[model samples]
Target chain A: MNLVDKQLVKNKMGMRLIRNKLIKQLFLMATLFAIIILGTLLYRIFTQGIGYLDWEFFLSFASRFPEEAGIKAAIIGSLWLMAITAPISLILGVGTAIFLEEYASKNKWTRFIQMNISNLAGVPSIVFGLLGLTVFVRLLEMGRSIIAGGLTMSLLILPIIVVASQEAIRSVPNDQYEASFAMGATKWQTIRRVVLPAAIPGILTGGILALSRAIGETAPLLMIGALTFIAYLPENIWSGFTVMPIQIFNWTSRPQEEFHYVAAAGIIVLLVMLLIMNSIAVFIRNKFSKRY
Target chain B: MLTVERNRPMASSISPIKDNSIYTVRNFNLWYGADHALNDICMDIPTNKVTAIIGPSGCGKSTYIKALNRMVELVPSVKMTGSIDYNGQNIFNPKFKVEELRTSVGMVFQKPNPFPKSIYENVVYGPKIHGIKKKQILDEVVEKSLKGAALWDEVKDRLHENAFGLSGGQQQRLCIARCLAIEPDVILMDEPTSALDPISTLKVEELVQSLKKEYSIVIVTHNMQQAARISDNTAFFLNGEVIEYNKTDQIFSNPTDKRTEDYITGRFG
Candidate 1:
């Protein structure tokens, strides 16, 4: 064949070898970049911090330096915060979602409320902290203890929970709702029986992720005047408390090298907790994704 | 088993009784935004019999059925006039409860949409909503309804299993059982078995035959044979109007209107 014929007969993009080679190189490079980013984060966390994760460190309370610093109070407080935050936010979010999805007629105000909720979820966490300081702690007169912090966290996570709940409620096939409706079921009956049960997996994943966000929250609690030094277990919601993120923040910001080690241990604990939460989120997601 | 085997199906049998008219639709006109979907139609669905409304798709068959239960009122742009009188009371009356009407006039969709729950829960859902909380009562309902749908023997052991885990046929049966549990006055099926296999279709058709003894059934089906097989009274609808409505055997064998005959003969649907 002539040069013109040979050119036309080759692959459309280019020569076969050239196209294949470029694609393979692109794939490898993309993968390599991902691994590098992940590796950097992992290396920085482990090499700098894993050495400080000993039994003595875990048993200690927060101090000026690594020698006396521990995350016991912070750990316990976070657990308390989560215990209060998750269920309350879940109930409120799911309630709002049901109202919007099932009952609310399409109107300008309802749509505006729904749209702004999603927007609120994306708002900076620090803004929520400031707002919480103004609203819950100051205006409502709830002091900046675990309770106040938890209520603030609830608001911070509420938007995301609502949006997540709406998604869960929406994911239920219209057929299931129709089936329940056709079964002489009232609107609430249908929702409680068919829609809620079907959307449970979706709701659970959203709820867990929302709780995870609550666990990672620091900015809101800090601004709400969360105590930086709570050495003892929190007795009530109104008492002074310190969350794990605050402890990590307190340590990481300190100039002393020894304090950094304490921060590392805090980071490790937070990471392990996050890891467990994330795995559960993944398990639920996979389970529902398959069955649903 | 009242066989009117005459060339012309005795129209005398049309309004046989006074108190038996379950849903009396009088001059029903419905509009969807600008389109006049249902045009001044009147229909009487007798109690305790399967009334199949057969027509080409988009001929107001589904719309008219939905209107009877006030479900069509759910759409924002839908404007409906006239009343649906059920058992001497207009269901669309402002004093009547919408939720209660919907509960009484139960519906089954074209697709098999069992709640993604256990077979037991799916059956018990309606009664639970109506406030039947006693375990013994609910258990009896679960068994009776599933048995009513011809599914108890197959699904009794798998009560706790998710309804989605069932085959499509079983899921459809579960939906029917779910409806039956409420013991509604009228049951509306919008092409319930159109999504199933022939065997599944037969099961549903048989279920319909038995259901008519307790509940007035209004069904919309695309299959002419299915209408002929299961329906006692048939209404042939075209262009949102009832072309011919008479006994099922008459509609299939000898329709009074040319449009109904053409539809049954497959010249046009």
Candidate 2:
């Protein structure tokens, strides 16, 4: 109502607008900082590695010389490791999730178990490697084999998958469960027919992310004593193996400048593999979401 | 003796329920944790007839019906005492399996809940789980059940289409057809038409009338007129107690209890 008060209100409004713009700029800068760093890293990798990524680069085996070195053995070994890791972790993880979600009552013991599982996911991966060394390699006599590495990787990612699966199962509408139960469906029948189908898209997304993490993991494999210079592909679950990360790690640490370029090429292959896996998961999730 | 009288409350009589009764509930009480959801419920649900339960919200009508098939046990903290006999066998007996009780008593909800599957698959799901796997038998069951629910003509050509593709009323009918596919003796509908349009409600009321000729139906409805229109017997529940159980005409026209009269006349819920 007064001239002085009106001017004060106008000044306050201007200051508030200035503050809002400043915060918006700050957030924009924060976002762009991450994007720019990632973009620069990608550009560097592509430029450093593109010359080495030829047909022969995928077909030949790792050699003493960088010019002749390839990731064929490492690629095959990683595939073999994943072939062992994916099923074991997924089945066990999903099974545990269903039991906890559908069957268990809400009690202190189950809550404790749930809390510990979440904590287990945050534990350092090297601890799992030590466990694998003591249990799988040394105690169980599985000694530096693909199965040892696969089992270690599985333990590392099992918590992530279980948590993801529990969320998926929980997200299914209560009405769906009630409908199935009213039809005289036993618990198992209802789960098999209704719950699993509805939750598959979410479960697949989690499992793929876990698997991609398993693929890129180097510390656990190194701790389990995976060979860093394997020139031959693994023949079976029991055979000694070296994955792409181990090969890349070895190349990056070598004295030769050419080996660092080779390491970049190996990183590109790993990224592509992760991209392919993630794309398949996204495709399946979209198809299921649309259908349902 | 000129007309069948389902008028008397079961507590006032010493005689056993008639042999034609599909369910005999005696002094049944249910608690959700510490909340008394259903208190001292006593009634007889007649076979091959429509029984409508009319009540205000939280009056235990849905709880009582769900207890008939022991579906109330799905809630973790539910506690119950007293007996509900389905076809002369106590459903709560340890020897009595829940699966068998549910096989005979299927429920439809207030909301249309169709499985996200093909219409044919949805119909066949109950029978398929019950071990009727032959294609010929499943096909016949689908056809008969869909026709029984009066949903065949609209969905017959699109049996393979997902059940979610249908409208709400069609989906409700599909759920009914799915229930019928199991060939259950009783169908428990919990306010099935509360979510429907007037035309759809009329269609479902007609279906319920026709359905009772083959299967016993117990429907809970908030709409007083709908209960009077579709039900042969009506029970008026208030505050988790059945205030009156009688023929539908008498309940609407001459409710013996003042509470039932107050509820039906819309003075207060």
* Candidate 1 local lDDT, A1-292, one digit each (tens): 4557765666465677788999999999999999999889877877777888888777778876577778888888899999889888989988999999999988999999988998998999999889888888889888786777888888888998888889988878766666666555677777876678767778888889889988988888889898888678888777888889988998888889877767877888898999899899889877765244
For each candidate, report its DockQ versus the true two-chain complex. Answer: 0.49, 0.62
Clashing pairs in 1: A61-A70, A129-A220, A182-B107
Q: What is the interface RMSD, in angstroms, for predicted model 2?
A: 1.6
> How many clashes show up per model?
3, 0
What's the residue-level lDDT of B248 in candidate 1? Answer: 88
Where model 1 places Cα greater than 4 Å from the true spot, the runs are A1-13, A20-24, A287-292, B1-19
TM-scores, chain B, all models: 0.92, 0.94
Best by TM-score: 2
lDDT tens readout by residue for model 1, B121-214: 8888888878899999999999999999999999889899988898888888888888888888898988888899999999999999998988
lDDT of 2: 0.91
For candidate 2 chain B, which ten residues in a row score worst on lDDT?
B8-17
Cα deviation of B109, candidate 2, in Å: 0.7
